[model samples]
Target: MIPERVLLTLDLPDEQASNQLGEDIAAALRIADVLLLSGDLGMGKSTLARAIIRAMAGNPELEVPSPTFTLVQAYPTRVPIQHYDLYRLGAPDELEELGFSEAIRDGAVLVEWPERAAEDMPKDAVRLSLSEKGQGRTVSIDAPVDFAERLQRSLLIRRFLDDAGWQHASRNFLVGDASTRAYESVCRSDGTAMILMNAPRRPDGPPIRDGKPYSRIAHLAESVTPFVAIAKVLRDAGFAAPQIPAADLDNGLLLVENLGTQGVLDAHGIPIAERYIASAELLARMHMHQWPQRIEIAPDAVHVVPAYDRVAMAIEIELLTDWYLPYVTGTPTGDEDRAEFAHVWEQMFDLLDDAEKTLVLRDYHSPNIIWREDRRGDDRVGIIDFQDAVIGPAAYDVASLAMDARVTISPELEAAAVDAYCATRARLGVFDREQFETAYAIMAAQRNTKIIGIFVRLDQRDGKPAYLKHLPRIREYLSRALAHPRLAPLVPIYRKAGIL
Candidate 1:
């Protein structure tokens, strides 16, 4: 379902007049679930955003900075706003690379000059248009389909005006529920407003399975309890963790404090290497934390990757052998290669069994970490996507980061990070440092192999060719891991497949 619809035509006398119009827009925004400002140059798009921000906080000095060059800017407010300028975008694929999806989750996003980014935006987004009309200005607003009733009932609008010491302006404005089930709007009788979100729910990703089994697993309540408990344990240890304010355990509905962007993977921009090291240090910290007796794995607890079992592993391998191999090279895999590949997988499994295991973030890569400037020390890394966390080999997460299945980390940076992580482990009381390194190498090789196969599948089966773009980098990581003596034995198999 999409949001409500509201169309408003505003006439402004001049650039300065846009501020008062902005104030009205801000007032309208209090009730509106999301506000979209669209206009051309000299049309005062930024001015309108500033006024709304000012009106929301009733603080005239609040800066509504333009995100034109930065791509996006997130304001710190009781109800935060995310501003985006997509005029300079070179391509739609750039959205994922720039991390726009994650930003939308944390706060309301406003985009200026959005024509180029139309393809990258939400399908049912609220749209607005601004144009220069001689000395005056004209503004047009279009709400998402069917959002009228909800917008009119929006709690934020009712509370905002009340807080500003005003009576309930008619409840005539249209509104809708927060974009996702995780977010809920709450406004008092006054105009004071804030959005409450359920922290337990992670963003919905590509469906990993089909039918009822996956359907049951996708719901927040079924999936979030374990991770919430895990975060509580981390929080007790003085780490920054997701806070769960309220939840119906059976239903999965929740109200949570918005933590803002502070995840490790969310770190970006120049000095990228420095941000990576910081994330590495935080992972090391989590790895070194002594597992408390209270947290025990239930025998029936589901595996993070449901398909990680023996049968699933075989199916994945078959997908590589039968589908990926032929499609990529038009050369069918021989029976002999299949036998050797299975044997190699078995050997890798044995090595995994032998390694000293620890808590592992099953998917520890970019797009999960939130970056915040105010955070102190290692706590700056706001880790998310831990619902699938597992108690597995210490090297699993390290491998997940080093041979990232998503973004590539340069060899030099990866080496420095591994060293840094190992050093942190030593400081945090993990002995047998050499064993950890060896385990790390073995896991790196194993993880990258699976990723290489998966990338091929993403392209061939899922029709996502973008993954192909990163295969060479994954190969590079595999080459580096193979260089380590511990993984030297497996290099030949990969080389045979032309994966090197």
Candidate 2:
């Protein structure tokens, strides 16, 4: 009874197989009070009707002789079963004479050749048809809401305005995360239901006069198949992620299973104390997912395509040297200071290459992690904002969560979460405590430096002045990470660049 579900053609090479399938359908629809069957001759129309009357209603021995000659057959069932073949009837009067309307009102009525007497058919009855396709037969059932009265209707019909492409049916649309490019809806048709996705071909972003390096938002789903693959793996592992109902692989239109109205940060009243535990569990699971050696994505195959590699990282760092310093101290990077930054970044990038790589969530923090009301057993955290996942240091995600740029976690809670993550990793035989803590420090330091640059760029280049308010917190995390012995050398270069 799930609408919008597409039924594959039903076919059997021999008569015996066809008879068995017919019996199955009959037994399945036995409880129905009214049934109407319509199909071409020699397409096994009467064969299916016979199977239902025999297998269902405990009438295995009842004789189901063809009603074609008599036009009607009555059987004694818990609910009277009336079979009518209307192929010969030219109008409603022929069927009305057999008391077909009264039969349906009395009990279950299975009517064959309904097209002959369509006008006389009961208002509340399931309509079925069979059509030959290639070498098989396709069966379609239309159980109107009035017939079953069990349909799940939409709360609002106006939402269909968004999915105007389907004129015959309506789809349910629900709001999604701001980062989401596609809208989700569920559509019901022919007694089968399917999730639908509505995405505009054109997206709104900065004006592209000539498409030359202006900031813009574009559909980048194709560039990150690994992220989607990992989402599938997580969902398979019984974690809660946005359900992908339908995907237009070519256009990035995805119908997703709706996650209801609640985000972790929005639902919780308490601060880091209660939330950190849930965040820790999800991060631990993400890090544990196996990283494939070779990744296939559009970006990977593009020739001479730019990646967010060392060169990109260096350009990003300069935003701090260029804009952030000016924002905070009203001073600019001098020639000598720029030289020091170049030297320090080169060394930092070199040192980072030696660190082991894993599947990193890139932006695994408060903004992306949603909490579940119940925390025990399975993960209560829902991780979102993961379009930028990458194979990088394990510390990348850990640092993003612990020293979050958007939300602050107290030192005590941060230590506890780190311990929990490390413990979980050790249980999985991935890494030991000594190795994890050391790598964590280096990654944390690197993340803080990048965030400082990002905050500055947002203020000067993007005109997002509100981010400047968090500069004090960013500076705090940077200072704390710099205190580590591993980042001692890097701190002096940042200090010379006025970052410290």
Candidate 3:
């Protein structure tokens, strides 16, 4: 007993408008959901289906031949989709011969002439009915119970846009990363563009310690407030973080300035030296500033920036023993071995007791950095993905920028970037290159080790296997960092863990 909770109607004045509507629906679709397109022959049903297929494939010119003749067609996109035309089916049971069940399990199902299936159609399927209305077409959408919430979310975006004075904005899906957050590019009627951040508050998982979830232990941002607070700090310091135009903090939504997609990486996806050097210099500049531990959200609201303390660091590295070691070795880690691992990390953490602490943007790499060529000096770099900002060792972000896990930063280039940062600090005041090098090496090893575990956890627990591809690169970074003499004490432990 699925309930029809929301019914939406739209008037498409032209084929362009119809196609845009199709794209919008495609963005809202998820795996296993069925979309039934109901319309009479030549009522633009196929045209809308083609638009959806093309949008999902991210190729405007993708060949999406109608399934009218073949009965079924599958497209391999980010989310695999099965397109079916039941118009020519001899009987409803013929769906079994066409692999309807398997198709639904694989990805989303788009069916034309679903009426032919009648009682055989899934009860939870979303139905869209189209009809000719003078010169334009009218569409009525009946969303099933499961889809009702998604429809609500879509309407929330519309409402947010209306409030932001961009009611007529067209949304284009943007790239998402290894977080719960998603984004879209909203193009206004005047051709101006902004970014919409959809970061729903995640419910806490099973308590890992003291009735607190792992996120609490890791000081992960539970709401959009941290992002807003951190962005303000960065922008006020003259950095290039996006300006928030409007925000629905309770809904975890924000319409922010669009920092163009010119990244620090080149055509080959490798880090460009000049941009990397600039990023390191930016980090140096940030380290010099005395950032506030707590940020003001509003007159009555304040966001306390968490310290990256020993407990947080220790919990992060536990991912190695908790997920990575077992994944790579095909065996669970022993309790004794886990104890030894913790002991090694505790000793390493002791060295950072008096290290220079500053606001560390945990993921300060090429992916989160936007290269604004028109801007000069530090402003040329636009930073994003800083919601997990912490008051920690300045070396952590430098390590993140240098030993970037996503892309291979050549040893020569890494050294040059490090040298540039050190040079900047030297020009400012007294700088200890040797002491900083030790901190850099230690942080790099710690960060890379954490990433190894995080990647494995993402694959095993989160069902995102794509991150596993970066493990080898991270392993190399860890090895290079562990080679530092100061980190020598933990060498045997790493070897024992089979990570070195």
User: Which has the greatest lDDT?
Assistant: 3
| Per-residue lDDT over 1-500 for candidate 2, one digit per residue giving the tens place of the 0 to 100 score | 44433223445554454444444444234234577787888776777777667644444456789988888998775446788887776667877679876786676788888777666666656766776766666666666554332221121112232353333332322333333343334443453333344332334455543552222212223322434555665576667766663344444444454444345344453345556766776667667766454443344332111223555456556666677667667877787877787787677667666665676657787666666675454457776555555566777788888887876667877787787787777777667566566667767776777677777776677656777777778777877777767667788776765557
Instruction: Select the stronger candidate by lDDT from 2 and 3.
Output: 3
Poorly placed runs, candidate 2 (over 4 Å): 1-227, 248-253, 260-270, 293-312, 374-378, 497-499
Residue range 1-500, candidate 1, lDDT tens digits: 55455675667777656665554444334221445567768788888777666655656677667777888777665456677787787787887777677666665667777777676677666777889887888877677644433333233334433443334332221222112233444333464433333333344555555533322342222455666566666677766666754444333333334455434443453226666777778888877676552453343432232213333334444555665567667889899988887787666566655566666666677655656668787667766556555566777787787666667677887887787788887887846777777778777766666667777766776656777887778778878887877666677877876767
lDDT (0-100) at residue 470 of candidate 2?
A: 74
After superposition of all CA atoms, the RMSD between model 3 and the true structure is 2.9
Backbone collision count in every prediction?
Answer: 31, 10, 0
TM-score of each prediction: 0.54, 0.54, 0.91
Which candidate number has the best TM-score? Answer: 3
Worst 10 residues of 3 by lDDT: 146-155
Q: Cα lDDT of model 3 overall? A: 0.88
Higher-scoring candidate on TM-score, 1 or 3? 3
The parts of candidate 3 lying over 4 Å away from their true place are 1-21, 39-51, 57-77, 93-102, 129-144
**Candidates' lDDT values, in order?**
0.61, 0.60, 0.88
